[model samples]
Each structure stands twice: as C-alpha cells, then as structure tokens.
Target: MSWAAGEFSQEEDRYSEVLRRQWGSPTLRGIYRDAYGADYPEEADPFGFVTRTDLARITELVAVEPGELLADLGCGRGGPGLVVARERGAVLRGVDVVEAAVTEARELARELGGEAEFAVGSFEQTGLADHSCAAVMSVDAFWMVWDKPGSLAELGRILRPGGRFVFTTWEPSYLDHRELLTEAGFEVLVHEHTPDWLHRQLAVYRGILGHRRRLADEMGQTAAATLIAEARETRSVLATTPRVLIAASTPA
Candidate 1:
C-alpha cells in the first residue's frame, strides 16, 4: 500500500515512535513474560497484557473456518493473531499504524512459517479491500484509537457480511456502546468484563516501574522514561476502569 506524505495524523506519528523504541527491548519483554507467567508465548512477543486464556477465548469467539481469512487490526508484532489463526487453521492479515511494528511482525511471521502478512495501517484506515476478511480481531490494541466510530466503520467496511469481530479493550466506555455498534452495522454478541486483566496489567505495570533503571540501560533513556510514565498513568485508572472482551457480527 502507498501513502501520502502527510497522511498520518500526529497521534499515529507519536505512537510510532513509542512502538519503535520499545519494539525489541529485552527488559520490557522479560517484565511482560514474568507478569503473564509460564503460559505466555514468549516467541510471539506480545506487546500488551494478554493471558493464554484470553487468546483461547478470542479464538473460540472468532470461530473462523479452516482456510478462511482473519484480520488482526492493530496487530502489534503479530503474536496474538498469529496464535489464533494458527489454532483455527486460518490465514492471517495483520495491520498496525506503526511501521516499526509492521516490520517486526512481518519478520516474526516469516520466522514462524505461517500464512500471515503485516502492513502499516491505522484503525480508521486499514487499506484493506472491502469484504476481504471472514473474521477480525484486535487484542489490547483497540483502546489506542481515539476515533472509535470511524474505526468501527472501517471494521464494518473490511469484514464480509456475517463476519465476526472480537476484541479486548478497556476504553472509557467499557465496551458497552451497543448503539455505536448498531450504527456501524454490527450486532453485539458478547460484552463482559475480564477481571483477570486488571491483575495482569497491574503486575506488568509494577514490573516496568520497578525495572526502570534496567530498562533504561537496555532500551534508551527516552523509551524507559516514556514507559515509566505510561505505567504510572495507566495503573492509576486500571483498577477502576473495566477491561472487556467483546464479540460482534455483521448482518448476514
């Protein structure tokens, strides 16, 4: 896909920098692995708080037939989507706004030897052909998009009729926007809080905060500072805000 010179909004540019810096940081990776425990797929190198149970639930919710196409929106590093697609025998198309993330995800896909592709794209503008995918998923990534309505419209545009839409997010709405989903041509199938998400996120944030000095040494000081700041800010609201897993489908 091609892009205009100024196509990316400022938010995308800033997130690109954050993902670029934190992409291959060993310190941060170790923290997440420890936080998530033994079931965590270390090779996949997930970028956020996702338990193995969460992945299995997502796979079940997606319910794609063998050889069908699954789109992973905001698929940072291609871990969660890769695992789900592999479990369901589905092909994978992963999209992210960060170029560095897309590059890393492509490399990971090559290493894992799966039918997967990654591209630099945003939630509001995936650049995917209309009705291209049988199922769509985003793991711990949807909350990053400030324009929820536009992104949902893009999701509706790309997914085929009757396609599944499964995502784990903790936005301010708590994934209870039934009206928004209806307007965007989706029927809400599942919406429930995942309390374990809070525990895992808190552990990860505390781990990051505790390892700031080591993270600074491994990744740059700038990246370490940003992570520390984010951990502090995010953890403050995590306990109060609800993390949710939501499943929806377009009308057949």
Candidate 2:
C-alpha cells in the first residue's frame, strides 16, 4: 500500500491505540472469530443484520472504474475490498486494526492474484497521501472511531478532487451513533433503507431468543441456554439501535 507520513491526528491516535489493544488480543479475536467466522461470512449475506449489502450499495454509488485507486477503511478480512478490486480492476488498499484480520486479507489477495494490499492500522489514522486515491470506502466499521470529524477530514485529504467517498454505518436512529461525515467534509449522495425481509428475519431471531428459556425442554438445554444468553445481549443492544446504508462523496 502507498504510505503517507503523519496522517493521523491526536484524537485518532488515542482511539486507534484502544482499538488495536482490543482487536489484537488473542482471546478477543477468538471470540469474534467463533461468533462471526474467520472472515465474517455472515456479513456477505443479504438477509443478515450486518450484511455486506451496504458495501455493495457503496460500490454502486461510487461507480468504481477500472484501474482506479481504491482505499478501504476498516477493511475487515478484506473480502469486500477484494471483490471490488477484482470486479473494477482497481488497485485496492485495505486497513484494519486487527492484525490477524489483516493477515487473512493479505493472503486472500495473494491467492486471488488481485492488485490488493492489506495493512494493520486504524481507519482513523491510515497513513495515506492527500489527493492520492480515486475512491474511499468503508463497510460497517466507522462506528468504532472516536473522532468522526477528524476521520472524515483525513478521508477527504486522501481522495483526489472529485473522487468518491462512500461507506455504511448504523443509522442515526441507532443508539451510540455518531455523525462523522457531516461534521467533516462529505455530502450524502444516496440513502437506501434495508428491506422488510431483513427486518422480519431479525425479528424472528429476536423472538426465538426472547422465549428460549421457556422452550428449553424442547430444545437442548445447552443450546437453549446459549441462545438465550446471546439473545439477551443482542436484544438489549438492538432495542435502541437501527442499522443504516449510506453513501457520500467528497465535493468535486
């Protein structure tokens, strides 16, 4: 990947340190891998809650052209970046805080023989040069950032004039949501709501867990207990959160 000097701000540096610490831990990584898979395969499912449709929509909005330089912020496992690079024949640069995730991404790129590169770093502080990239995108990963304004400003700096910047996030209606792009220098180009089927599927999953304890005799006690625990946690969080699909671009 092309490197730049002193790209991250002080606030970004602090957040990156915290994220790196958490994602770099072996225990936490294992837990995440167990729950989500090595590459988060569920993210690619259209009906899944944290699906890759957001990234797909961003690609459509950005209209990635052949040979374009594309930078993927918070590119977990590099799956979305690899797909975009392969389809558009773009040079892909991916950055993530998790070391193992970065390693997996690099391996995938190598196997696919695509012009892609991966790095272990935070999206808030990627050392990419100003006006160097043709497009910038992120997939379901911006929420962890502590300084939304600084992060978006950095994205603006790296993108060439008139270049596209697109990403997905939990909708503002979601709890713990932050306004990073508006505070920085991006304009929303398009917004697509998730389909009804997706909401229905999520509801089913939630409903099953709500009464999992009562149905423990029918389902295996171990499975029911585990499902109940997971459901309890997910329901507690989702009660106040709603995911969103968003695309934005830097001023031409």
Candidate 3:
C-alpha cells in the first residue's frame, strides 16, 4: 500500500530497509513462501497484500499474449511481475529506483528461468522504447513516486495503443483521482475501491509481523515496530482511505 501522500524519500528508505531485513531472514521468508503455497518470490511480497488471488485477477485483466511485454513499475524483487509473466506467457520488464531491488529482481528472473529483465530507473523515466509494452501494472508503489503525472506520462509513452495499465494502490480521501490520469492521456476504465479488503489484508500483515516478532527483534525492534505501527495507523483510517485497483487504457 501507499505509505503516505508525501513520503517519496522516506518511503524509499523504508522500502529498501524493510526489504533488506526481510531478505536476510530465512524464517520470515519461509512464512511468506508458505503463505503463497510454496512459490515465494526471491523475497517476500513487500506490499503484503497482493496475494495469489490478486495475482490471478491481474493476469486475467491484462490479458497478455505470448509475445507481448508487461512492464511493472516499482517492481520490488519482481514478485508480481514475474508471476504475471509466467501466467500470461508474456515477457517481463521491471523497473525500480532501488539498486538492491533491481538486483534481486534480476536474480529472481534468472532463478525462475524466464526471459525477463529488471532495470534501475525512476518513475518519470523508465528508459524503455516508445510504445513497446502491451500491458503495465504497478502494485502498491505509485504513492511513493514523487511525480505521479510524469510517471503516468511515461507509462503512456511506453505503452502501445490500447495497452492496459493496472494500478493497485491506495489514495487519500482528498484527491481527485481522475484528473491526473486523464491529463496523462489515459482513458480511465475502472477504479474499484476495496477498503474492507485492504483492512483485512492489513490485519493479516499485523499477524505476520506479530508471528515473527522474534525475527523482527533480531532485525531491530525499531523497524518492526515502525511497520506494525504503520499497519495499525492504516487500519484506523481505512474507512476513509481507498484501496484501489485502477484499470486504464492508452488511447488508440
């Protein structure tokens, strides 16, 4: 989920630090692997909400072809993108600003034995060719971006005509969601707000963090507590918050 409306730099540090800590913990990794029914990403699902169920929905929504490309933005460790690639028989391209995440994603792609690539890039510039991707998905990463409008423009530039863009993220109650998307040359199709679902996932996340309290302590109590506290905060305001799945298409 999105950390906050304004946590671009702070979000980056938290993401990388948490991911690094989780990657180093075998017990926590095992828990996440079991959660996914034995197929874990190179690391855990940092977002904590994109379960296997969401994976299937996204795969079907994108409707990718065998030779098509799917670009995943803020694709930490390439979990969702890799799964979508495998499910749709589509090539995978993941971009993240974190070098560590990009490295893990590349390794995961190699380990999974697929034609996938990961790059260290920013939200406003992905370094991809124009009109090259057939579909794109960003999971729980867009809110951390400093330039949502520019990022949407970049997605429009890279996506082929009629290419679909799916984003699963959270939005504050105060924003006009459609204005930026429309301004970036997209036709917004569906925006499903599922705050109840998001709240349940947050509970699961808190349970996971509580279950691995010892591991969290080993990593550092401050980090673990910070994560759990954030989850609690989200739960408190989930009624007002909107956990969203936005599907839009590039103009033909």
Q: Which residue runs of candidate 3 sit more than 4 Å off their true CA positions?
A: 1-10, 26-47, 194-196, 208-215
TM-score of 2: 0.66
Write model 2 residue lDDT over 30-109, tens digit each, in one string.
33334333333332221123434444556676676888889988886677777766767889999887776677678767
Q: Relative to the unseen true structure, what is the C-alpha lDDT of residue 109 in candidate 3, on a scale of 0 to 100? A: 81
For every candidate, C-alpha RMSD to the true structure in Å? 5.4, 9.7, 3.5
The lDDT per prediction is 0.80, 0.59, 0.72
Candidate 2 at residue 1, lDDT? 8
Cand. 3 TM to true fold: 0.83
In model 2, where do residues sit more than 4 Å from their true spots? 1-55, 174-180, 196-231, 236-240
Please count the clashing residue pairs in each candidate, in the order shown. Answer: 0, 0, 0
TM-score ranking from best candidate downward: 1, 3, 2
Best by TM-score: 1
Worst 10 residues of 2 by lDDT: 1-10
